[model samples]
Target: MSSSNKIQKKTKSIDATKKLAEKIKKQALLKQKELQKSSNQDADADADNSTTHTALSKATSTSPVSSTVDPDAQLKFNTFAELKLVPDLLEAIQQLKYTKPTPIQSEAIPYALEGKDIIGLAVTGSGKTAAFAIPILQSLWHAQTPYFGLILAPTRELAFQIKETFDALGSTMGLRSVCIVGGMDMMDQARDLMRKPHIIVATPGRIMDHLEHTKGFNLKNMKYLVMDEADRLLDMDFGPVLDKILKVIPAKRTTYLFSATMTNKIEKLQRASLNNPVKVSVSTKYQTADNLIQSMMLVNDGYKNTILIHLLNEFMGKSTIVFTRTVAHAQRTALLARILGFNAVPLHGQLSQAQRLGSLNKFKSGTVNILVATDVAARGLDIPSVDLVINYDVPTDSKSYIHRVGRTARAGRSGKSISLITQYDLEMYLRIEQALDKKLPKEDKPAREILDALHIHVDKATAEAIRQTKEIHDKRGNGRRRKNYDDDREEK
Candidate 1:
């Protein structure tokens, strides 16, 4: 209470804060070293090693990753099937052709099924879906009442993808599930709430919308609550919405919070959202398998599209995702790729739910080898055998770079993250590198060979005409719709 006491406490607190960050940094550095070391070994082995699996062989260069075995866990346990999965869920898993429990599933399911709140620290495509979904489904099977399960994802793509996971696992039991997110019919979601569905996978904003607008859409019976990508949801400032949902929903529900990185803010969010908790971590930060061959290239601002096109051609026939900064950028990149004769598609927030689903399905089915997406389209949507993740626009931050690269090299698969940096992108590139704690290798002309693969060689005059027309359109002539109103006004 005295100033002297407060000063001493403050000094101690600063010291403690430093210690915590250092602890996290040290743990992160250690894991990163492991991944880097493994990557070095894998890279030394083959240029075309599959990015998603551990069974690495030069012969299976075209195969999608089949499995990723955690070395640390192998010492303690061999497979996920060894874990005591409840009968019904195990049957469901078998039907889905899942032969083994992924690392997250193996680690998280037991404690979660025991009714322990969980903090799952794992990367995207690390099988975190099954980690939480299996336990929740198993719990649902035993409950007498049709209590709702609530899941909050950071993006519409992730929310919908989570719904798909639930749908797959719960289909046999007739457990109905719905995904609620922005850019969709909120009123329809409100109507669906009246149906008393067993699970609702949603983004924070729309879920909050339903809670605020719908009558008798009570979450008082919500028995399971999950916050996927907790850091991003919190970073995007969904805290108020998350809190409002918490305030209105039953406080006694079981909670699960997951994130790739455990920042201080994430810690506070967990404290706010979770009860007594169990922690399940597959790998510490940067502790991924050492098979990813990450690199970066620098280009001029005007030549960004040219560079991205070259990379796509160079890596042609490989399933890949390009992370663009905005929806417009995604569309531009997709258009350019298509114009140049690449089988590419755009995936972004502006698209309808049907389009989003269609794009991802096309990519997954390998009908389209290149998918361009905004950050919203990047998270939690798993498409197998993606060999490369190109940051057409280098991520504004490191977390995004991680999430972007994570789309590839999933499980034990070897993958690569290629960043295209221009002069304007220098600051952002440095920030990403700083956060990632590394520097990129500079390549002189990575684009020359890839450019040769591009088939769009139109004359300058033809391009000028199209560019002029586009410029005119961009100035808001045809894009705007004229609204006509009746001259007569009548009182209601």
Candidate 2:
């Protein structure tokens, strides 16, 4: 073909694509209006008999008002039923035994159902996932369109967890959702995308890869965009990638930005992405759950490992996570735990995607009762029944400390966190206490004779673990090992 003919052909294709996108958007809008009409009719029919419907009607009467829902805000809707969720969602919630909405859920869901942009600020494990998932699924139920929602998570683990939530909640609705994350095969993900799922839960980096490299996949007509863990996403320098994604997706879509803390970067992101969003904050500052029992153990650096073993022994047969600051620490700690006869595993970013998932499954399924993890496991992961969180290494910052401990004591469950405070960690620990506005009480030390006796076994285990780790590193070769063994900093 001649140059002019080729140019004209390309232009025609572009025009056709735009027109198709417009058609899809119109159809989605029309379906949504119909769903709204049906919902209103149902509400009117049951309003006299349903106090829940009356409350929901009053809550959503305004045009997506912008206001903060404090932790103590009188909850407008207590139960999922009172939130006026569709019967399908209500049934799923009932099956899941979710009797009442968490504060964040009760505050955010009603506005989200009203098609409003939202800035949801809540700590980890406050039912933030369900807060956003319920509304998105409800919208998907009404519209039934492919690629109806796109949820961006910070880590691959979080992406998969979010997909699981969507699948479970939308089970009765026959929901088709795919998780697009790194560490999995690209071709497999491409095939999943070809299936045209209703929701795409993904980490920003991998999703951006698909958007750029994968043919026949895009989010141009996606109706809902949820940036879960917005602060962590920005902290990982996903702002540039998020900007690119925001450019491609339709601006008319509803957006929900949920974060633990609203930093300057998050505020900037909100301004750039959300439009007149209602800000719902369940907790205004850095705080752990009230149900969490936090204490500190002052230890000498030489005996830190022994103290860790001592605590693990006390909490034996219970689900616990040991938080380390480095990949090597996590690996060696898990090895040490196993040497001393603890059912333990390690999870960090250094492991291949398969290994990471395997470790998580082992911990989640009770195959392993202990997980030694880096900061990677601290945020946005919903691991239930964590009886204790042990801070093997004091987190570098208060925010990180909060997230690490947040892994336990979730959803009103009682849990405990013990931080090992060395002389070096005292300054950092004090900063954390200042951030929380309360000093943590000192944990009673075990009898000296017990610790002295335990030290012998721990020292032997430590020596064996170090030797094994060194051998493994040597086999991998120094240069390659160094390249791959960086701390668990970025998700993928």
Candidate 3:
């Protein structure tokens, strides 16, 4: 009986040990999840809380006369609903699921609805599209006025997006907006123009082509002029063409300029193009979307690839867009990433239109997880949700950075922008920060120990490199490592 009791006690001891091991494993998993939550770039830590009112709602709160010398002076808006939009327009807004007005809406819509000139400094996706789009629809509603509204966009992609937004809002109304942009069907656009659309959303180059090629293209009744991305347009050589178009346009017409940033170029164009106009900006300083958390990484040219590899190892499964400075850089980065077994793709202007569209569609659908792109594909792109924007190359200037980072942190969703700065980019980095007027936090390189923990597999060449590096360090005996493994191996 004593022996049997002793055996039972030993068995119980084994059982307790097993239970303790299981408990420890579960605890480790929970801690890992917590660590991941803390480390994720887009951890739902912030969101865009600034879009108070949609365009018309935003517009109505402003005073007609300047209350102060500052253009940002607050104006009184009774409400955007006071703009007296057609019932069908309201229904369309409701169908699009917009319940209330944006700030720009409250301020600009009332004046615009009254057929007054306006200036809008709202950010992209701040419902600026709808701010002008709604007014355009309201102004053209049941009007006998010719050439309903003329709105110019900076990029073909943006032109198409604006037309799409309009289509959704005008589904119930008797209005049609034709898109005129580069790279697709000019003759077809000429044919579209023959229909005499109440509104024309066009890129400058294509519109100029239509003006040069198509006869009887009169702006006799063109009552409204809108520059969707005013700053970008004036920044490009589109200035001369736009200036000429403005000359042909009816001088007495009302005008509106909407841009993410109002650069000096925009100011020059505004003075040249817009009369005493109403201006509104969401924030005094142009920033990454309110929801985006921006950080910076410093690397040498040779280290960029290894750092990116390490980042991917850590960020496993998240969608990321890396913005390179040129098409060749985009192509090379995409290929290198793919060769490294990353789900990567290249999207740039160098591809045929079909190819560009195809790559975008694949990335959007999650077939390809990472996209290396130039600014051409970056504008007016609204993916379902972008997890990160990496400036593989720091932008030429702050405006470029704004547009690139704007690719993420859209609507009310959260995102992040990481600038990869190489030694060569030092000067450009300072300029970018100077333009931004905000200091970027420098993040330490990710923990290499974590890479080992995750069992990351590097190329044979890379592995050989790491081995040689450790050997040299071990020889130096700087005490970073625990011991000189090479010496130990030799003694063995």
Candidate 4:
């Protein structure tokens, strides 16, 4: 073989090896380019994800309104439709003339509808009742079971008011509710319970009484438990009673705790009763409604009554609630108003249940333009037409002041609260102002002519109120237990 032929074969082998290496190198470059492209795509996706997250965060946390606009005002909801409530509830809301959900309702209804426990902080008349009620009714309207929900309110009036709301909202669904409050007969309540009502609205004390004494009556099947005016309910020392009720009911249940303000007791109650709850607060700062006009008129203690009479004259023919510190004061004030030719009635714990209901009816029906009440009427009574709330006496605490003034300016209607502040009430007035986070407007005292004109009726009214109050006490005493002939004769 020639040396040139052998070299050529070796060169051919080397050429083949080079060609294979070039092909391999080209494949590797292509693969590298593909991997780089994939990495770039992933980086683009990460950037997109970051952009999405930031946009969502902005949407949820930031409002489009101007910086000068109220931040809380951005929480407004336009209609009940947006909350996805069922037709029945929407119909009831329409029939009740409620066009939109209040802030508390809008924030709370969804969580409640999702079957979550809730801690709602909103003032009265913010539609907290409907917030919980609509969900409870929606959940339980189809159930054949009895006593599906139990609501504990701080006062009997509030209990009744809650029951009324439930009945009104659930009217088309044939829902039945029993209000177990003290002023009513226990036997009657027991009878109502026998009917297996869907809801039980009761004050803690009366409910505890019925739960302990009533035979075969229990809330073992209660699917929901709601504490309305939760601060006052817990602050009133209903813990033991609430615990007993909780123990009796099913452990798996939804609980709603609503309050005008948060307190340590309410927090403890949350720990005890509510599961992991969504906190929906419309007003974190202690503040009244936007429409409430609160004012204070400084006057001498002796002139307080005269000023009240004049104010009543000024606002006559409009419904007013006069808050007094004592039952006797409420009675005296009402009697005085009545003697002044104003339609007035007295409401306090001391009044018989019949008397209390009568007074409330008169005030609500426009039969009487004025209701003189102690703190018993403060918390959750929903009288919508009250044009003014007169603090005939300064409230003992800021919460009381809030509740008393809350009687008017309800359901978004504008109203006024004029407090009669004497020199003795200066400290309390200041405390209320501090709690409100704003000072009340100062108003000029009534004119001399106004006082002088009303002064003519004061003496006659005072004497008649005193006599009628005595008669009321006598009637109550006589009704409670029969007095012996000798005792009656001695009293006479």
**By lDDT, who's the top model here?**
2
Estimate the TM-score for candidate 1.
0.76
Over 1-492, each residue of candidate 2 has an lDDT whose tens digit, in order, gives 899999999999999999999999999999999999999998887876588777887887665355666666678787777767789988999999988888898888888888889889887899999989999998888899999999998888888899999999999999999998866788999999999999999888778889999999888889999998888888876878889999999999999999777677877887788887888888866978889999999999999999999999898899999999998899899999999999999998777778899999999999999999998899889997899999999999988998999999998899999999999998899899999999899998899899899999899999999998777657768665554443233343
lDDT per residue as tens, model 1, 1-492: 999999999999999999999999999999999999999998966644554344554446442112233534642334546667667667778888877666677667777877888888876777888888888887888773554699988776777788988898887777888888766676888877777788998888777777778887778888999988887777765777777888987878888888776667867876677776777766656543357778888776755666676677678899989998976678766776676688988886555567777898899899999998888665667776889988888777777777788788877788887888888898988887776677778755554555444324522323543565365336634323111010000000
Preferred candidate (lDDT higher): 1 or 4: 4
Of the two candidates 1 and 3, the one with more favorable lDDT, higher being better, is: 1
Q: Mind giving the per-residue lDDT tens digits that candidate 3 earns over 268-351?
A: 776687776766656444655667888999886766766777776566788899898976578767766776788988886545
- TM-score (all chains, Cα) for each model: 0.76, 0.84, 0.73, 0.80
Candidate no. 2 TM-score: 0.84
Clashing pairs in 1: 38-290, 39-290, 51-413, 51-414, 52-413, 53-412, 53-413
Error of 3 at 483 (Å): 61
Scanning candidate 1 in windows of ten residues, the lowest lDDT window is 483-492
Q: Write the per-residue lDDT of candidate 4 for residues 1-492, one digit (tens) a residue.
A: 999999999999999999999999999999999999999999999999999999998877633111111325744468876766668767887898778777787777777888888888887778888889999998986674798999988776788789989999987777888888765777998999989999999887777777789999888878999988888776666777778877778888999888777788876777777776888877754668889999999988867788888888888788999999987799888888877788888987776567777888888889888999999898879898889999999998988888889888988899999999999999999998988888788888776887777666675677788898788667767545332222212111
Q: For model 2, give the 10-residue run with minimal summed lDDT.
A: 483-492
